[model samples]
Target: MAETVKKATRESFGEALCELAEQNKDIVVFDADLAAATKTSIFQKANPDRFFDCGIAEGNMMGVAAGMAAAGKIPVAASFAMFATGRAFEQIRNSIAYPKLNVKIAGSHAGISTGEDGATHQCIEDIAIMRAIPNMVVLNPADHWEMKAATKAAIEYNGPVYIRLGRLAIDSFNDPETYSFELGKGITLHEGNDVTVIASGLVVNEALKAVKVLEAEGISARLINIHTIKPIDRDIVIKAAQETGRIITVEEHNVVGGLADAVCEVVTAECPVKVTRIGVQDEFGYSGPAWELLDAFKLTQPHIAQVIRDVVNEK
Candidate 1:
C-alpha cells in the first residue's frame, strides 16, 4: 500500500468550503472568532465578502446562520465542537432545525483529539445532542478526503446538518479518487466474517489498525466507517449483527448517547447481538496530548484489538 498523507479534517473542510463556494454563490460562512483554529480562515481569505465573523458568541453566530439560511443562502456556521453544540444548541434546535433551514453547522476540534485543550474544550456529547434534533443530519468524517466529500454533500443537501471535524491530523485511509460520499450510508473498508468493527471520525483509523492486528491473529474483523451518524445506515448494522453475531463500536466520543447508543438502537430493533463499545467511559477528559488521551481512554489500536478479541471470545 502507498503511504497515505496526513491532514486535519478541518483543513479539508475549509478547503472544500472554498471550492464549493466558488460553484454555489448562495453559500455563506460564519465563524465565532475562531476562524484560524477551525480553518475557516481559508474560506474567509478566498471569499471575504461571503464570510462573517460573529465575534466570540457562538449562539449569535448560529442565529445569524439560521437567518441567512431562511433568506435562501446556504450558511455554514462553525466553531469549536463544545460551543457549537453545547453553547448554541437552542439556536440550532429552534432557529435552524425546527424550521428545517439549509444551514450547515461545522464543529471543529471535536473529541479528545483536541489535545491540551482539556475537558472544557473537548466535545464528547456533541453527537448525542445534534443527533437528537429533528431534521438534522449529523456527520463525522474520518479523514481529509472524507471530510471534503462530506462538506460538499452537506452544502448540496437541503436540510440542517451538523458536521464534526477534528484538529488532529490523521492518515488518509480512503482513496479520494474512488471513495464516494453518500448520506446515511456506511462504507465497509475491510470485509470479514468473525466480527464487525464500526467506527467514525478520528477513531476509524485506529479501528483499521486494530483490524489488521486481528487479521494477523486469525480473527476476521470487518471494518465499517460510519461518516453519517444520524440516519445511520440501519441495514449495514443489521447485516453485521446477523453475519458476525458480535460487533465492536469504536469512537472518540463518550460511550453514552453516541456511536454505541446509535448502534444498539439498530441492533435491538432488528437483530440483537453483543456489542462492545470502545470510547471514553462517561467521563470528562483532562488536559493532555491527543495520542496520550486516546491511549489513556482505551481508544488506541491495541485496546480496540483486545476488546474485539474479548467480544469474539464471549460470542
Candidate 2:
C-alpha cells in the first residue's frame, strides 16, 4: 500500500508471521522443508525458537501442527500449495478441520502462475479442496496489505484457516491506512448497473483494470473483490446478482470448483443470475513463464476486458 509497491504475497505471509510473533508468544511456525521457498525462512530467521522444520513430509508437518494446536499453541503449517492442500489433504481434513483446531495452514505458490513448476506443482484446485472441509476458513489475499491483514485475521481467529499465497510479484492495490478487511465480506471497488465482475486472489487486480477499460468504452460494470471464499459475502453477491443481473467471476484457480462455483452457488439459491467464469479450464498447466501462462489462459487485463465486452454485447 505504499506508492505502487510490488511484492509476492508469500513474502508478506512470512513477514507477517514474524512480526506478529513479537506480540504473541503462542504463535509457532512449522515448515515442510520449504522455509526458503514458502518464505517461512523470514520467520525462522527471527523466531528460531518458535519455528520448527518438519523435513519434506507435508502430512507429518500438518499432523505436528495439529498436535501443537491441541496443546494450546497457535501453530502455522507452511508448504507449497500442492503438498499443503493436495498431498496432505486427508490429514488436514481429519486432524485439523474435524475438531476445529486453531491451526493456520499457509499454502504458498498457488495457481497456474506458479511458473516453471508446471502442472504438478501449480495448485489450481486448492480453493475447492480446502473449502470442502467444514470449519476451515479459506483466504486468498490479493496484495501485500491484504495478505498482511488476512494473516493477522487468521491468527486471531480461533479456528482452522487456509491462507493462499501467490508466487508472482503483484502490485499493491489496497491502501493500508484506508483499507479494512472483513473476514467474510466482499469489498465493492466500483459500482455499476450493467454487469458485475466478482474476482478473487491474484486476478482481482486484472479485473479492476478491466473494469476501468470497460467504463471508458461506455460499459458500466461493477467490481467486487472477494478475498474470503468459504464464507463468501452472500449479501453482496445477492445484491450484485439482483441489481447487475449478470456476473463474471475471475480467479487464478480452476473454474470448476473455485471462485466461479462459489459465486454461482450464491446466486443459484439466492437471486438467480447469469454467470460466466474466467479461469483455468479443466486442464493442467504446462511449464512456462508466469505472465505468459496467465495471458495464454486469458487471465490478464485485456483478456478480462474482452470477456466483459463479449458478455455485455451478448445481451
Candidate 3:
C-alpha cells in the first residue's frame, strides 16, 4: 500500500490562499511578521502586490484588514493563533465581526500541537474567543483538502471568519477526490449505535483510528467530524445523541468552550445524551516535542480508543 501523505494545515492554508487568490482579484493578504512560520509567505510569493506584511502588530493588521474589507476587498489576516485571536480580540470583534465585514482570519500554529513554543504561543482558546463574537464564523479544518475547501468557502462567505490552522503535519484521513466541504455541516465518517465520537481539527484522524479500533473490538462507535465550530451541525449532533445515546467529543483544544462545548450545546438542547469530553483540561501547555505532547495530553489513538471503550461501557 502507498504511504499516506502528511501535511500541516498551516501549509494547506497558505497554499489555499494562493490558489484562491485567482478566483477573486480583490483577495488580499495581511501578515504579522511571521509569514514564513504561518506559511502566508506562499501567498506573498505568489501575489506580492496583494500581500501586505504588517510587521509584528497583529491588532494593527486586523484593523487594516477591517479597513480593507470596508474598502470592498477580501482581506485575509494571517498570524499565529494566539496573536491573531488573543492580541487582537478587540480589533477582530469591533472592526471585522461586529460589522460583519468580509475578512478571513487565518490563525496558524493553533492548539497544543504547536511544540516547543509552549503555552504562550499555543492557542487552544481561539475557538471560544472567536466564536463568542457576533458574525464571526469559526472553522477548524482537519486535513489538506478540508482546509483548501474551507479557504474557498470563507472567501466566498460574506462575513468575518476565523480558521484554526495546526502546526503538526498529520496523515490525511479524508480522500480529496470524494471529500465535500460544507459550511456548518459535520461529516459522519463512521456510523454505529453503541456510542458516538465527535471530533474536530488536529485530533480528528486520531478519533477515526479509535473508532476503527472499537469496531474491531465489537464495539460499534460512530464518528463525526465537526470542521466548523461556531455554526455547529446541530442535526448530526442531535441524531448521534438520539441514536447512539452517548457522545464523546475529542479535540486538540481545551474541554471548555471548544468542540465539546459546541456539541454539548446542541445535544443538551435537543437530545440530552451523556456526553464525555476528551481534550485539554483548561491547562497551559509546556515545551515538548509535538507528537510527544499529543501522547502526554492523551490526544492520540491509544488514549482515544480507551476513552471510547469507557464511554461505551457507561450504563
Top lDDT prediction, candidate number: 2
| TM-score for each of the candidates | 0.98, 0.99, 0.98
Q: Write the per-residue lDDT of candidate 1 for residues 111-227, one digit (tens) a residue.
A: 999989999999999999999999999999998889999999999999999999999998998887688899999999999999999999999999999999889989999999999
Per-residue alpha-carbon lDDT of candidate 2 for residues 1-315, written as tens digits (9 for 90 to 100): 358769999999999998999999999999989999999999999989999999989999999999999999999999999999988999999999999999999999999999999999999999999999999999999999999999999999999999999999999999888999989999999889999999999999999999998889899999999999989999999999999899999999999988999999989999998999999988899999999999999999999999999988994
Which residue runs of candidate 1 sit more than 4 Å off their true CA positions?
1-3
Off by over 4 Å in 3: 1-3
